[model samples]
Target: MPASPSAKIRANVPIPLSEKAIATRFVSFSGLNDDKEHIAIIYGSPEQQEAPLIRIHSECLTGDVFGSQRCDCGEQLHEAQRIMSAEGGVLLYLRQEGRGIGLYNKLDAYALQDTGVDTYTANEMLGFAHDQRDFTPAIDMLKALGLKRIRLLSNNPHKADDLVKAGIEVTERVQTGVYVNQYNAEYLKAKVDQQDHSITLKQN
Candidate 1:
C-alpha cells in the first residue's frame, strides 16, 4: 500500500480572511502549482462545528467569473456558497478549467460545440481526457484544514470516489442540481450519459 501523506506536509499556511460579510480564509499547496487554484474556508455559524460540510468546486472562468450560462457551473458555484454560508463548510476552488483542459482549449471545444459536437466528443476531438481533473490536491487541502471527514456537496459520483480513494472520509453526499437551459441542454446530457454525472433535466 502507498504510504499515507504526512499530516505535517499537508498543513500549510492559514490565509487571513478577505471578505468581512462572509468570513473566508485562503489556503494553498506547492503540490498544486497553479496560482489560480485556491481553497477557501467559509466559516459556518458558531454553533455548527462538528462534521463541517465541504464543496470541491473546480473553477469555471466563463461561468463563475463572467456569469456565463453555457452550463450550470456559475449557478452551482453561487449555490454552494449560499449553502456553505448557512450550514458552514469549506469550498476548495480548483483552477481546473474546462475539466483540466485549460481555457484556450476550452474555447476551442466551445467552437466544436457550436458545430454540433457534444462536450465529451469535443474534448475527445481535441485530444483530451473526458475529465482530466484530479482530486488529490483537494484531499491535501482538506487534510491541511485539519478535517478528517466531510459532508461533500456535489453531483458527480467521481468526486466522492476520488475523495475516498485519497483517504478523506466522506460522511455524506449532498446533491447540488442546477437548472438546464437550451444553451447547455445537450452539453449537460453528455455529462450525464457519457460521464455518469447524476444530473436530471428539470421538468417545467
Candidate 2:
C-alpha cells in the first residue's frame, strides 16, 4: 500500500499553521511540466456539495515571496489562506510567472511601467500580450480533484469568465481586496482601469 496519497496527489502532507490554527494539505499534481509544477494547497473540505471557495493564483515571486507591494499578489495570497481556512477552500498555485512571459521579461515590463506606461501596454511594448496567462492548467487541477463548481475568490473577472467558457462553473465571485499603499496606488488603479479587475482603489 502506498504510504502517501495516490499518484495523482504526489504527496499529501499536513502544514501546521501556528496563526490560523487550521489543518492545511499541500497536494502536488501528477503530470505537469518541470517549469510549471504547480501545487494545490487546501484548507477545510473542498469536496462539499456546495461549491468550495477557491483561488487560482499565478506565480508572483516578487509579491508572494518577497512581499513586493508593486502588485496585490502577496496580499491576495494571505487573504486567500485566511478566507479558505474559514470558508473551507482550495488555492491552486500555478507556476505561470510574469503572466506566462516568465520572470526576467516581467522585470523588463516593470522597467517600462516606470516610464509612465500602463501595465498591458508595457507588455505590448515588450512584444508580449497584455495578460498572457492561461487558466487551463488550473481547470485541469480542479477537475482532477473532482470539483466541477466553485465559488471563486478573485477580483479578476477574466478568470471567472474564462473558467466558465472552459466548462468549470464559477458559482460566485468573492472579491479579494487589500489595503492600498503609495507604492501600489497606481498599480492597483491600473488593475481596475486597464485589466478589468473588480476593485476600486483611490487614485493618488
Candidate 3:
C-alpha cells in the first residue's frame, strides 16, 4: 500500500542472555525517522521457518527492568523469550516507552492511575492519546529482516492489524499468558475493556 520502508540492518551479534540456554542475537537497525535504538532479538533461525513467531514489545522500564507487578510487562517479556527460544521466533523490542508517551509522562500517568483511574483515563487527563505508539518503525524493522509472513505473539489485535496494513501477513496470532496479580488486575481489565485485548481473566 505505502512505499516500502528503506530501513537497513546496522548490526547483528549473537549474545547469550543471563538465562544462558536461551540463544539469541541482538539486531540493530538504522534509517528510522525517530533515530531511537530499537533492536530485534532473533532466536533460533526465523528465516528458515515458514511463519516464525514474533512479538513487537514496547519498552517498559519500571515493569520490565524492575519487576514491578503494577503491570504484566516483565512477565510477558520473559514468556516471549521462553517461547521464542524453543519455537524459533523474533522479538522486536521497540523503544516506545509507556505506550510512546515517554518515561516521565508515564510516571505522571502512574500517579493519576494510583488515584483509581484507568490507564487510558490517566493519559486522556494528561492531554495525550490513549495509546501513542507508532508501529511504522516496527514494520520497517521487519522488512529489513526480510519477513513477509509471521505468527504474531500478542494479545492486542492492533499489532496484527498494523502488520497486515504494512504488507506483513500475520498467519496466526498467539496470545501471551495473562500474568494478573492483585496490583495489575485493574490495569489488565482496563486493557481488555478499552482496547479489546484477547485475554480472559477471572476476577480475583
Per-model TM-score, in order, reads: 0.85, 0.89, 0.95
lDDT (CA) per prediction: 0.75, 0.82, 0.91
Candidate 1, residue 159: the lDDT equals 90
lDDT of 1 by residue, 93-172 (tens): 88788999999999999999999989888899999988887776677667766786788889899999988887778889
> What are the root-mean-square deviations of the candidates from the true structure over C-alphas?
3.5, 4.8, 1.7
Model 1: residues >4 Å from true position, as ranges? 1-22, 31-36, 45-48, 202-204
lDDT, candidate 2, at 161: 92
The residue ranges of model 3 lying beyond 4 angstroms of the native Cα positions read 1-4, 18-22
Error of 2 at 107 (Å): 1.3
Error of 2 at 25 (Å): 0.7
Task: Give lDDT tens digits, candidate 2, residues 47-147.
Answer: 86579999999999999999998888899998988887776789999898888898999999899999998778889999998888877778777877888
* Model 2 ranges with Cα > 4 A deviation: 1-7, 33-35
Clashing pairs in 2: none
Model 2, global lDDT? 0.82
Give the per-residue lDDT digits (tens) of candidate 3, residues 1-204.
233366899999999875755578999998876788999999989999999999999999998899998899999999998888888899999999999999999999999999989999999999999999988888998999999899999999998999898889999999999899999999999999999999899954
For lDDT, the strongest prediction is: 3
Return the TM-score for candidate 2, rounded to 2 decimals.
0.89
User: If both were scored by TM-score, which would come out higher, candidate 1 or candidate 3?
Assistant: 3
